[model samples]
Target: MPLEFVHSPTQQTFDIGSRLTRLLTLLFSLVIVFNTIFAFSVLVNLKSLDTCMFLSSDCSWSAHIDYIKDKAWSRVNILRSLKFTLDRLTLETINMTFIRPLLEYGDIIFDNCTAGEKQELDKIQHEAARIVTGATKLVSIDKLYSDLNWQPLSDRRTNHKLIFMFKIKSNISPTYLVNLIPLRPADPRYNLRNSSDIPLIHCRSTLYYNSLVPSAIRAWNTLDSSFKSADSIQSFKRLISNTPKVPHYFNTGPRRLQVHHTRLRLDCSLLNYDLYRKNIISLQACLCGDSESVRHFMLFCPLYTSYREDMFESINLLVPGTAITLDLLLKGNVRFTDPFNSQLFSIVYSYIDSTKRFI
Candidate 1:
């Protein structure tokens, strides 16, 4: 690709600038110099890269969103090729490597794109989740993300945006970007409650609502005082882990059987009910004669009563306050901390595996 000159954009100015695209002169000399000197250089092509894809007469990237969408789905389609070959964990890692960077390429700017735009990107994430977990198209997109313990692209963008905002506040980002972040003025007379936080940029235009400055500031101000007090960006990044986009499962034990648990959670297992629905069997009834279902299989299956009894006993001993329920055993609970939840999942899956229900 050859150098293409671009003027610094004037409108929709509150943006994630130079993160990918920068105004480079069309003069071939500078291009050659940059190419030779820099270890990494992206050819300045608006159509080739998303950073400059936002360029339009109206300053709306909505025009190029389709390009980004198609590009992402292409990458996802490539991941789909490995759907059957790789395990969930490996597939997820590959997805993060190939697809996530594409989706998040310029999310600080994409963060403020229209809902339709965000939804398009989200579809890619959901599709990746489906591929990674081996879930069918019938699985709920949210459910796929939940089972995989992955954040939606929107939440992930918010996270990256907050981190970027933090960098701007710390004066590590570009001067133009840093200058855009306004700190709340300190005044003694009637110091209001939220005075410690940054101020929001009031804008009348719906387009401005998604501007990087206001959106980042809004999310930044919502942070806890402790988060704001962090001296280094690393600590702040670590703290972000406490807030998951989707509630995470402890997900312990061998990785292989986790999918079995997911099948149970999604109720897409080889249970007689699912089998009957697929017309694989004449009856949905269990050998014990009740309608074969998740509740029946996990809770009341007389066949697995012996293993189920031990699983419940371990859960009760581990977390007494937790009420015994299908969800608790299947999905675990948010109230249970990470370590406890791991133990809970271990017990539940242990019982399920012993039953050889999905084996």
Candidate 2:
């Protein structure tokens, strides 16, 4: 029985392997055709649009700046037209509440702006400040910013980026951006140098890399220790929002008075002398035929002698026998040592107000 069972050495079998391969090829061809049709449809729809609706995943400062300018200028123009009807404070409020928000709607877009672009955007803010405060053409931009409690657009953008990073770091929200930023190492050796140390990223495109992660990390590392040590993301935001904008030296007194003092110090007053200087109106000279300058009004003008004497006495009380020099008055270089520089500002404000009627 065993010898009777025999099998052929060369036996033909079903070609299942070739059949399966043909099936896979047909499926792949259909998939490719479907994808091609879908892509064509997308391109056709995109071409039909008047303007491109999608933002590039990569940051484009030029596009963002143009868009922001368009949004901001519309509001700014309205404010400018109403300059006669609106006071400085009201104008500033409108800018802060309405115009500024428009400018800052997608502030993360500014994180990658070149220095030149940043300066250009900052100029827009400077222009807004000038318009809001009615500052003359001659007023210093820095002084205007100080007066308005506004940070440069560059600084604001950095703040916004870091705040976003903080939110990601604190797990306040789950975002793909968190994966781009590496967590600090637990090793003491790694963290010994800077409390806010961040690991370096190696990539061919530094700008793109910075746009995604390094910029935020760099900004966060430079933050004050208090900011770094915040207990929660919300607390961190609250602290940042309430933080003093200007340096302690310039942040003296009530905000309103600070604004007034800034105007006076920057020669933005509506005195006839300043008006004539700005060519807003014609005036030959002071009544005494002296060249009408801030120095002349604050110090040498005969009309303000009484007020000058009172101001000097008040100033001397702070720093005994401190003389108010032209340099001191206009440049804020006081000889006296008030930590906040409040006394010098107060004396200057008083002197300017006192001379207003005389002018």
Candidate 3:
């Protein structure tokens, strides 16, 4: 190999440059191939990320929120289309049994949602309330909520979060949520309003404060002693179900009859002649010659004389000296006691059934 006499410097430089260019080209090709394979892998494994398969500790909630919104809105659209046929009770049942479960499932995602997103989600529930109760656009949301015996979505979310925390604290739930929440001794001398309470650790980030542990701690700390002292998860759930503010009447009467009574309470029934004035129906109440309003039909109509006596007897038994006025009949202004309210509902349901004879 050392037999060559001499070589030109320019030729040697050119040969070295050619070899270097080939090496650079091979390296660039490998880099492109690896990049393409990585991109493909990301696309293929995208779905696994939703359930936190790869990143268990720091699961992203945005995807979960998107999924909920898409699913909830689709159901809402279906419910909206069925507004004319289903009555308030049936609609509420569909919401509680069907749509509500969808929202409540994996609700931890809601904790990460912004206030605006929460409100957007709540609007779907608001729309449902309007559809079920036959409330017009002008009806106040508060009135519809009270009549329907529904809790606002925000409150529901809060309740779910608190309940979840209670489960974790009581060792009923086996999840990583326990690591975030810590138990502290209650100060007996202070006489805190809430008996079963947990101390909240100060968090530097708003995200941490708004998370399941801290937010739940805050909510659980504000609950009354009776609720905090529930012995089991079932007992806790029962106490929450019996909360006076949001009453549940599923056991009181058949749903179909309950709907009739609900319609009467809202004064938006198909039989109401007031709907005819608004061009919603063709016929007015025949007996009165006036607009067959709920007040006229329920109170003043001579047609219901036989049934009216029984209705009054039931009402009096429920709440003695309870006045029957336009506002009371329409808006349910009087607050009858528990079993009384149930009894009153039964009376109203019977009265509604009696009126069907004339139709």
Candidate 4:
């Protein structure tokens, strides 16, 4: 028996490995030869599809997201293979170039997904970052994102959706999509606060509640009026791109150098102060009979005086006349210029090496 189905004039379906048991139609006489069902709302999402985009009996993307996850993890395997040869910058470039596009493709399907499904996607990114930077699974995922300046997938999805919403708002989207966005009309004589937003209608189903346009609108309405009022799409993107709160410094150095720097920044060192706080040591004091903290380890310790003096002199040469504050050198928290030069890092790394703080 052949599968019978109705086709929308605009949509063209591919053999996506979906099985159709039966089709409901008044005309049961209309017979069609096909094996798979249409991926409702996720058609032709991006050019050159890699995995089969399937639609189960229910119109859901939970299974589709799993296909995407499998593809993404395959790329992460490649990234892991090249880890020894590639630095953080190169690995991140590879991920953005190859893996990211796949994860972001057909983002509309994500609208109907549950929070747990979205978390599966987020975990892929977290693992990718860990593999690239050689960070162990024991490392805090948040710390890895912060140190590497990587945005979580959920935020990235929201950003992408808002960009599409911007296109619709700016009248740059296709007529079909623009018409589909549920917007309420405003009065000419009076002003209303919700005029620029999509109406919060009662959704009888959770699917309707979390669907594409409504969720996008909810995110859209949260933005400042100035952001939405951009004259051009590029301008709008610029405004929203900066919505993610960036850390003080975005590390671009190699992973070999970065792992130690990350450990120092996170205060995961074996300092007696840290040890004492963890109840591993009785007192937070140095062998020189002074407090053993990062400040003491870097600047004031009597033991590493020669190495510390060398580090100070080298850092002075690199950043002439600027005050060497604790945060500045340790975390590279510069307001204007990045003072974490290669020479300065070498000096600091060398100083720590001599003190054996890391070992």
Candidate 5:
């Protein structure tokens, strides 16, 4: 009987090599799996974050149906869910979290919040307060994101109510888009604040201008409550309430009316009289002298005496009588009595020149 005892170093080396290969292969596979997961996550975050919910399933952060069915405000926790969802929103998810909600419930978000579910109403107020308080520190986008991130999540009621709010916000005016930033918090521009312009949940007052009573009534009541004389209060209220409404006449109105009247007259008379037909004479009649009528403007008006004489002397024409009649001047066909023409001519020319400058 014989026993084999010889061992080769080469055999040992081969065995170790096989084990190492297996270990290396397993490690590489694990790395590949990790890498695939990482890549998928990055892609999902980048691609879907900016987009809003495509379906009800996409917003399945809660069992909303159950919460709604119960009609239990405490259990709803809509605001808290919204806060959580808001945290999930990134620059990538801006449209989904902020813009989409704005487009949907913008009116409620900006104004008219009475229709909002209680939870959502609370969230809106919470958000508004946070925005106002943090405004000074929120100069940049990153800071804004961070501040919002720390805000407490809204409750279930806020979440369910937000659906309607988003729906209403969608109809806001383009000007209100500025409200996305905290530029003018109290200015009330762009429907961001309540206004009497529309009948909405917050501004549906039955009194004049949405008041419970007339302003005069309110004032009188206040005075009467203080023990003022009844007759005095009544008289004061009547006097204030019956104050006459004064018409405000803008300067432009009267000026335009006069200009229109003159333009029409001049345009109409142009054919009958050649001299008067020209805008120069017509404008002079409308503008120069104490007698504002067109007839006084062209012929006998004293205001233009010095001006007319100067023109006449410059052109080497005999100074026509100040008393020259309009009809005589028109028929005379006196072609350029003065080389510089009449004062009326210069006035009209100047008027046209000024008018053209603005245009």
Candidate 6:
């Protein structure tokens, strides 16, 4: 029989109410089980700490130790919720890392609501799950889930009542079962926070107007080998004062050119397709495609090993013992000095820019 044809308004409402109640009961049971599991995990992990001992009021312990304890407690709550729901509801044992613990908290509170209240809570949770599931991250969820060996739960194998329960307990969307997954954060229409605020109003005119120069000056001051003497200070100020005037780049202010940092060189070469490619791709080593990240390209990719070989030789000339990891470069430990560093940075930036140009 057709679903609509079989439905009586009174019977339909009763069925809906019954389905909702069962879902709530299942979800509530899950939360209790999850909480117990989480508490046990924490108790086991923190066995080293005496439960009877006073937590120190000392500032150092208060700052670091207390902060860790609070984070652990929050994790305990979420894990406990997951364990509780899974045990009572007969859910397939899937890895729980993809689940958001905070949303799990919301789900626990949601299960206790009245039928009408449950509907409202469901709406809120669905929306929140939509936001979080569609959030901006270093990697794509589809790719990440595939890598993590997550199998989509089918409605045929799974209980329809429990499907509703999954939605309630996991705070997850039922959309995945239908093969409709979200676009990643990189996509323009991806339903996540995708835009940053463009500064329209300047809070401080002088600071805003000379934003580039001031940042450079501040960066120079912050360097490990910062300019100290009066002569050095004068030279730094001269660099700031002599920057070329940008045409309304930042309210049409003049830019001062200080000592030639490779960062400034790269900024100036943003339009240079080759240099931009290398720099941007290098910077994004941690976040690029499955096998095409900066790390993979620099240290591992046979396709780009020639570039790595050249860069390594250059580094060996300047600072002989630098690792090729992107982290080491970002930390300024990888011998980024003078013409050698500048040439290397430009090459990498140019490579990145060239790839982007073709794309």
**Counted clashes in each candidate structure:** 0, 0, 0, 0, 27, 26
What digit string (tens of lDDT, one per residue) describes model 1 on residues 133-250? 7666556666776666677777778888889888987888989888787656666467677767787888999778888788888888898888877899999888875645444453
Model 5 has an lDDT value of 0.34
TM-score of 6: 0.20
Indicate the residue-level lDDT of 135 in model 1. Answer: 66
lDDT of 5 by residue, 44-136 (tens): 443432322222443321233233223222212332233322322222243234322332332222222122443453444344322322222
- Model 3 residue 328 CA deviation (Å) reads 6.2
Query: For every candidate structure, what is the RMSD over all alpha carbons to the true structure, in angstroms?
Result: 19.7, 29.4, 24.8, 20.5, 33.1, 29.2
Candidate 4 lDDT tens digits, 56-95: 7687787888898878887777777767566666677778
Write one digit per residue (lDDT tens) for candidate 2, span 257-324. Answer: 44455555677755557777777878837777886666677778897888899987887777766566
Question: lDDT winner among the candidates?
Answer: 1
For candidate 5, the 10 contiguous residues with the lowest summed lDDT are 245-254
Model 6 residue 211 lDDT score? 33
- lDDT against the true structure, per candidate, is 0.74, 0.66, 0.66, 0.70, 0.34, 0.35
- Using TM-score, rank the candidates from best to worst: 4, 1, 2, 3, 5, 6
Segments of candidate 4 deviating more than 4 angstroms = 1-52, 186-190, 243-255, 268-296, 300-303, 333-340, 356-359
Better of 3 and 4 by lDDT: 4
Residues 1-359 of candidate 3 have per-residue lDDT tens digits of 67876768988899899999999999999999987895465335322213221122454555656666676676666666656555556566766654666666656545665777677767778877877765655445776777767878777777787688778878878767687677667556676554446777798988777877678878888877778778898888777756454444423555556555556555556565756766776878646576677777778788778888888887777778888665554344335555665666677778777767424
Better of 1 and 3 by TM-score: 1
The worst-scoring run of ten residues by lDDT in candidate 4 lies at 33-42
The TM-score values for the models, in the order shown, are 0.64, 0.60, 0.56, 0.71, 0.20, 0.20
Model 6 agreement with the true structure over 1-359: per-residue lDDT tens digits: 65566678999999999999999999999999998897677446434322221234431123332333354354444444444233211111111332223223323212322345334323332322222222112233343233223322221112222233223223354555322222224534544332321112233654343333222233333333322222343453443333332211111111111111112222222223223355543432222333343345435656555556676676667566655556443223333444444444444454443334223
3 versus 4: better TM-score goes to: 4
- The C-alpha local distance difference test score for the whole of candidate 4 amounts to 0.70
Which ranges of candidate 1 are over 4 A from the true structure?
A: 1-52, 186-188, 243-258, 270-288, 298-359
Q: How many backbone clashes does candidate 3 have?
A: 0
